[model samples]
Target: MKLFKSIIYICLITISLCSVAMIYGETRQSQWIDKFIDSFELTNSNFKFYNIKANMMIEKDIDMNELQNICLLIAQNLTNNKDEVCLKTEKSQVYVNYNDKNTGISIVGIKKNAKESYIIVDILNNKVYKNIENIYTKLENELSEYSNDVDINVCIAGEYTKKLKKAKISDILQKILYNMYAEKISDIEEENFLSVNAYSKLLKENNLKYLDREINLNIGIRYSEDDDKTMIYIATPIIKIDY
Candidate 1:
């Protein structure tokens, strides 16, 4: 009986040590995520994430299926772990929770453009003005030709700036993605929609006050050499807004 009791005590000690070790490991991961977020100069209001998880409010009328696909694509493309992607929708915004296994990065997607369209990005851990400036510089260099035709506006929302100072990451990822889309789509055939002509036609058809609101255009293309078929999904946020 004495020997059995001694063995049980030793097992209990072993379990306690294992539990402590596990907790420490989780704490370390959380800290790494927090640090990465802080590096982006994030604030509490513009974005808030705890334990690298966040909850957002999305409208009930929003398309959850399309949001999920985009979220999944982002996770697959940017993060090391695909299994970490989790999503839930509320009345106003869809909440996405995922850990950057490589960097403990947290991200959220807000505001859908169309059925499966959303603006999203990793929550920066610190102020992103420098990063934003870098992007702007790159845009200026790349868009030299369009400088005459296009007026580039770099407006940083006050709230976003405040959040950056507080080390809360916001949705700059969406902006970066949009910039990338712009670059890629511009290289595609000019005959596609969203050429200057298309924009003019859309504006005329809708009788829109184009100056009042910003327009976001997305053109998705998938080409199959076997069938000689190209599938294109062009999404214009302004058009959706008018509808």
Candidate 2:
């Protein structure tokens, strides 16, 4: 009876740990959205980060003040210090920032309704050392208590979007497109497929008029194993911001 009781306790402890991990992985969705920020190294081992934003939603009856305090706890864990601030307002989310050397992690949690609230984590660092998905997963585990006995939805990601808007390759491609638009090519030429680097080489720096440089580039292309297959080009919409 003693041996059986010990085995049962061990099993219970193991099950508890597994349940916690499963909660963080299954309840948090936004971290998986982090693939948009390319973590590839420029050289053999050096890595840098660009602007990236990811969204996660929490379904619970939460208090603003309590959540803000929880965010402070998370910020402390992330930064290894007590430097944290909560920007609270009636309508806006309980925003918090963990001040760091580079642009730090900015978390904004907004209440969608009494039962649902959304949180967005925007990484503005010039270079990020760790993978963002991992970082947010850690954060989710820490904040899992807030989601106790509630409906939590986590989005899983298998791949990044092909449309280059806000992608790592977007800036360079936009430069090339600006040059073509500068020449005022009314007779838009269509190539079934072309390499991004090769297409940029076709246009010279002088060809760019600087007009429409701020326009968004929507590049959704997939490489096909079949040589005869062609990439499809879709019309891109230009979004204007009032601010």
User: What is candidate 1's lDDT per residue for 31-125, written digit by digit as tens?
Assistant: 43333233224322232211111123333344656555655564454445677767677653556655542233334555554432333333322
Off by over 4 Å in 1: 1-62, 100-104, 111-117, 123-243
Query: How many clashes in each candidate?
Result: 26, 4
The residue-by-residue lDDT of candidate 2 on 1-243, one tens digit each, is: 999999999999999999998886554443223322221221112233333344456677777776666656656665655645545555646777765676566767787787787666554554553455566556556555555422211111112223323353445334435542322222223333322212222222112222434222222333244443323221112101110
RMSD of 2: 15.0
Please give the lDDT score at residue 130 for candidate 1: 33
Candidate 1 global CA lDDT score: 0.36
Q: Estimate each model's TM-score.
A: 0.25, 0.43
